[model samples]
Target chain A: MTTSREIRLKSRPVGVPTADNFELASVELPPPGDGEIQVKNLYMSVDPYMRGRMTDRKSYVPPFELGKALQGGAVGEVTASNDPDFKVGDIVSSMFGWREAYNANPRALAAAGPMGGIMKLSTHGMPPQAFLGVAGMPGMTAYAGLLRVAALKEGDIVFVSAAAGAVGSVVCQIAKIKGHTVIGSAGGPEKVAFLKEIGVDHVIDYKATPDVTAELAKVAPKGIDVYFENVGGVHLEAALNAARPFGRFALCGMISQYNETGRPTGPANIIQAVGKSLRLEGFIVSNHYDLFPAFVRDMADWINSGKLTWKETVVEGVDRAPEAFIKLFSGENLGKMLVKL
Target chain B: MTTSREIRLKSRPVGVPTADNFELASVELPPPGDGEIQVKNLYMSVDPYMRGRMTDRKSYVPPFELGKALQGGAVGEVTASNDPDFKVGDIVSSMFGWREAYNANPRALAAAGPMGGIMKLSTHGMPPQAFLGVAGMPGMTAYAGLLRVAALKEGDIVFVSAAAGAVGSVVCQIAKIKGHTVIGSAGGPEKVAFLKEIGVDHVIDYKATPDVTAELAKVAPKGIDVYFENVGGVHLEAALNAARPFGRFALCGMISQYNETGRPTGPANIIQAVGKSLRLEGFIVSNHYDLFPAFVRDMADWINSGKLTWKETVVEGVDRAPEAFIKLFSGENLGKMLVKL
Candidate 1:
């Protein structure tokens, strides 16, 4: 019998989840039923938003149930298939659980499902790990949130927080491709340098800057036209103050306060959003599932043409997944933090 | 020479203006020049935004200069005219000053000028004072801010704060006309009653409701889709919490904290905006000048068809203009407040 190692939620976490909140165990893997495929996990993504799912509160998506395997975006290779569409050796990405190996029901992970069931990975120049970072959920998020929700235009100035992270990094690159002047904020000088190397016009080390608004103003003399919000609290307040009249703010994530026990202090200059006629919108990448094919095509073209570059911070083993996820909050990862089993 | 009583700004106040800030004096009304028109001011509008003009700081419009006549949206009768477009005994509205009588450079308020100046008013179907309130800047503000900026649609739920005030009252009425479920919050029971009489689906007296967000929850079980923001502070905070996912907020004014010495306390749960994917936009009516003609037509139709209602709290005499303007901040006036000369 095949065996799979799974990470299950032990309890609802109060604050930054400790290792005690999760339990790793091995279980017997069931043989694939008709129209199903057995997937051997390759890479498991660790994102900030997964922290929200750890709680039992009502959110855009349901919370993770205790004693259940923690689920997230994952890329795997099909080892066995009863379905004609997916053959052995075929690589695919799905919103599967944190498991070393499992049988994936074609219907459950199929592209026709509401939860954006599994899809075949593009056989382009980009690596399969890019499916979890750029050209995946994060890349689609930057595209939809910036171009669709934020309504970004050429010559607009963009300010992206958490610039070295998965989503923010792609947002900066997409904004640049659209002919926008891009400025980014990251936790350290190295990530800031990385952002600058990847076509970001300016980079602000948020840790080094005492006054975020002032630092943003110094970089964007004409003022920020588009603020791609990822880290909330002080960053959001600073963005509000620095935003020009009629600016557009894309509310993507709030990594700064995600691991807190209670609600974090929100922006203090929110009234400025009203006076300046700013547009702030929050969105989920799943809402734009219709655009995935279009996104993959464009992203592949960009990657082939040497227009877009991506980096992955891969944790070597499955046992390090929890540690890698926790490190995201501490700003330890330079790019997309993933666990390779 | 014809004698006219005029009120001018004697000095700029640091915070709230006292009687000493304004000077009432008699001035000689000169005869109309080549293209000038002599207007006998019948009613002078007193609006909250005039307070912003009292400060030396630059805003959407320039501040009212010290020792100069305080200009506002006013309606008057043309006693004499040298321009062919305007005739004697014609009642018109313009950005005239707080005066009993004055001569206007007809070219300054003409529909089409060398520099794209003000448009002349047509007093065909309703009260002349309507030109300053429901059919003027405030009316256009409610129309454009809601329709264009907020992208308000039929069947959407709406919430308006300071519901009995000039802009809010008009906003509620306009939303109702567009087939929206309208709820409003006002400072007193009387204003709440007025809001209901004007077709608001629900009314909350903010003075009585200690937790405005809780009160909003009871009334708006589905949560608000379009929020016409006028009074900021706790009300804004409540609105943010009560807004549904993908809701849109049109930030028009913040009367609640306008007089505060420093930056007003912003919304505490602004991070919720990211989760809900809400859209908040700040706007000025002056920026939407192109929508004026369409606004005038729709407002006139509503008025003539008895589909819309309005209230005017007229404070007689030009000397009472300052007190009338101050009453807006206190929520003492119902609907549009005007000072009759």
Candidate 2:
């Protein structure tokens, strides 16, 4: 048996999660059996989506079991291997997160479906943690949601909320690279500046502007052709009002409303969808695994050419996983939030 | 010169439209010029969407101008043709409505764009009036919203609100034809009976059931793959509740909240969209004209095979246009509502 430390969900949160909601515990792990691999995790990803898994409700993904290690994306190195396809020292990524070491038989996990597959990472001389950030889920999300979901086109004016975060940053950059005018909304001047540096044509500092819709209207005077909805409520309403006829909205995530105590008020003006002939579609990226290889190819090219940039605010140690996750809701993290093992 | 009778918008209605908002007038029309043709109207369509045109809001389609003739789909016969394309006695469908006679230049109208294209009808061995309903805008709405907007698969079980109405009726039939189980929700026992006659697998009398979500869960215990939204609010919430993972919602209209003075609470449970990975897309049939030919071909085959049945609630005289339009919200119309002139 091997001793491994992990983060566990002690309790579900009522509103914004507190430190008490999570617990750090040491667990015992067995050695890799036949056809299995043992991994020593290098990094654990703490994302907004993990919050949903903490809630005890039936959703697209199952709720994280209480007192069990919270699962998420992790990049690791194989310490022991029994599978012929994998070897020791091979870098890989899997959804078995918040733990220091694990023994996994991938073929056995595959029976659980799409959520189970372990991906072998080709870093191409980049840091392993980069696989947990822009070169990973966030990057693929922006690409698939834009091209595949919204059906974005050239000359289209795109609006992105949470514009400096992981997915939003990539959305704005891709929209610009594809010959579309991009508008971004971030909470502060620092994020606003980052958006500008990345070539967003228009930027709105939503924290400074009490009325985001009015600010958006000023920046995007002609109206937006596509809206990438990352924040719900006011942000969604602003996008709806600013969307032109036949606008398409790719519903990625609604981070702002995730921890609300009661049912948050939806965009009151969603009826505008009817008047504008809007297509608002919500998608989970796991369903679109077929697009991953193409995404990685294009993203790697962009990074190599210095046309793309990635940001991360990483907290060290498994004990601090709760703090890192809590910081996401607080909006203190600059971009993708990660916890190091 | 010919004296033509038309229905004009006197004033915008506050809540539900009344006779005070409508005015019948006689206008003199000049002779058809070089390329123009004069048409004598036989049938005019009054639909729920026209209600949006009555208001002063800037929408996908322009609002109705006060003291001007209300425009919508109309089927008529050409009385005089100066253009080689159209001859006298030819049946044609145009978006110039509530008028007994209209002089139109086909080329000039087509240049104005998709909305202005006047389609000459072959009657396809069906009644010319069918062009305004099952075989025209509403029929196309169902076809496009189902196949294109929803991206429905063969095994998809579809839930349709306003199931006995024009668009909803066709949506149910098409879903059934595609080998999908269909659940239809209508306001009364009569409408419920009609849905049953149309081969809807399950029927919900929404008026009798206070909790539509419960009713839907009872009927569609396994959950639905697609929801064809006609009446919004409660129906949308119910569909959201009854939706399986990765369900598609083709949001055609929101007849229930159309006349609200204030912003009606938009499906309080819209957050369910994120959990379910639901796609809620609102589309105007006009934007999907590219699929019209295929839709017409399929619909013609269905009609010829006696697999498709169409019902029309026609009110006599152009003076009763407002009454016909008002009847739509009252749930009195059995199917496609029309006014005969």
Candidate 3:
């Protein structure tokens, strides 16, 4: 038997989740049984969407149950394998995070569901942790949202909220690489600098700005054609206000309103959507797995050509996973917030 | 010479428009110039969307200018014509309403942008005024919004706001004709009865319901698949609250917020859009004239087969057009409100 440290949900959060809402625990796992593969997790992702799962409500992803090991995007190395599909030392990705190591049947892990199933990772000279960040769900989310949901067309001026975060960074870089003028909005000066470094044409420091809508209007005088929505509330209102006729908004996440105890007011200018013929579509990255092959191909080309880049804010150990997640709400992380085990 | 009595914008209304905001004026027009046609107005449409144009602001359609005749859908007979395309006594439709008679250059009338261009009406055993109501802009709006924008699919349970109004009534009947269960929402008992008379599966009197969201959830226990958003504010919020996963909202109009002095608060539960993967798209009927051929065909078939029916609240004369327009906001009209000249 092998003992692994894992974090479990101690209690459901009402508004903002605290460290007390989670508890680290030890789980004893027997050696890999028949058709089982043991994985030692290297890096675990802490995403804003996970906040939705912490609440006791039905959503696209099921609510995280109390007293269970929380699940998320994790990249792990195969330590022991009784299955032919996965071999020792092979890097694999699974929806089984919040743990240092786990021994499970390949069949059970395959049925783990939501996001990608258990699959061996092809590093392609990229770091294994990259799968959890830039080359993973967040990256795919930006790609599918911009290309499919938003139906990005030629000469589309794209505006992205949370431009320094995991999904937004990728969205910014992708829009830039596609030769479209990109406007990125982030909370702090550091994020603003990061957005400028990523070749964004216009960077709005939302924290510093008095009126986001005014700032956006000033920057994109002609109005934006596409809005990659990450933060909701004010950002959504700003996007609506700055959007040109027939602008499309990809409603990826609303991190700003996730922790509100009371129901958050939607964009006051949402009525503008009618006169402008705006299409606001919400999407899950999991629903867009079909775009993976194309995404991977484009990403590989961009990565090889040194046109694409990323950042990671790593928190060491599974014990600090909750801390890393909480930091996401405070806008502490510049890019992908990850727990390095 | 022809003397025409027309309604002109005296002053922009601060809130809901009133008779004081409008002034009846007389204009004398000479006989048809080269390529000009003289028209005698029969009926003019008074639609909710005209309220948007009344405001002096940049929008999809240009704002209605002050000290000018208010432009809208009107069916007229060409009394005199110098244009070879138009003959005497030929019925025509143009954006030349709120007046009794006028002489317009065929080129200028053809260039009269927004909605449908100037065209002769076939009438097809339907009333000539039906071209301005069910078979014209409102009817086509319902068809295009439902089939194309909302992408109404198999087994879609549709919910329509302003269900007894011109556009909404057509939407209710079209959905029913296509064999989809539809829930129609309208204010007042009269509108509710009108909805029921049109084969609407479920009728919701928004005036009587204290909580539209709860009422919607009650009626659609299994949840709604599509929402035709004609009335915004609380109706939009209710739709968001009651929408099922992957539900689509065709945002046609927002009459509830048209006259608001302050910026209207959007749906508080708009975040549910992301979790539910809902799509809310705003569209103008003018952009969808490409669907008109199919729309006219479908409407003709439905009208001929007696599968589709409509009602109109006709206010007599050009002078009463302002009163007819104001009645839309008060929900006094059971269906399409028109000005019979």
Q: Largest DockQ belongs to which candidate?
A: 3
* Candidate 2 Cα outliers beyond 4 Å, as residue runs: A29-38, A78-90, A106-120, B29-38, B77-92, B103-120, B124-127
lDDT of 3 at A306: 98
Model 1 — TM-score against the truth?
0.95
Decoy 3 TM-score against native: 0.98
Q: Taking the candidates in order, what DockQ does each have?
A: 0.62, 0.54, 0.84
Q: Write the per-residue lDDT of candidate 1 for residues B1-341, one digit (tens) a residue.
A: 78888889998866666788999888898798888888888888888878888888745668888887888878888899888888887888777759888887767555454222333567876778888788877788888988888898867899999888888888899888888899999988788888889899999999998999999999999889889899887788888888888888898888887777775676767777877888888887887878877887888899889888888899999888888877777888998998998
For model 1, report DockQ: 0.62
Candidate 1 lDDT score at position A77: 94
Model 2 iRMS: 1.5
Tens digit per residue, CA lDDT, model 1, A1-341: 68888888889888888888888988898888888889998998999989988988777889999998889988899999998889999998888848888886777555566674777876675677788898888889988888888889876899999998888898889888878899999988889889988999999999998988889889888888899999987788888877888888989888888877665676767767766778888887788878877887788888788888877888877677888888899999988999997
lDDT of 2 at A270: 78
lDDT of each: 0.84, 0.89, 0.91
lDDT of 2 by residue, A1-341 (tens): 88889989999988899999999999888888999999999999999988888889888788999998899999999998999878899999998889999999988887778666777878998889888888888888899988888889877899999989888999988888888999998888788888989999999988888998999899999999899888888888899899988888888888888899886776777788876788888888887779988998898888898988878888999999999999888777777888889
Residue A4 lDDT, candidate 3, scale 0-100: 95
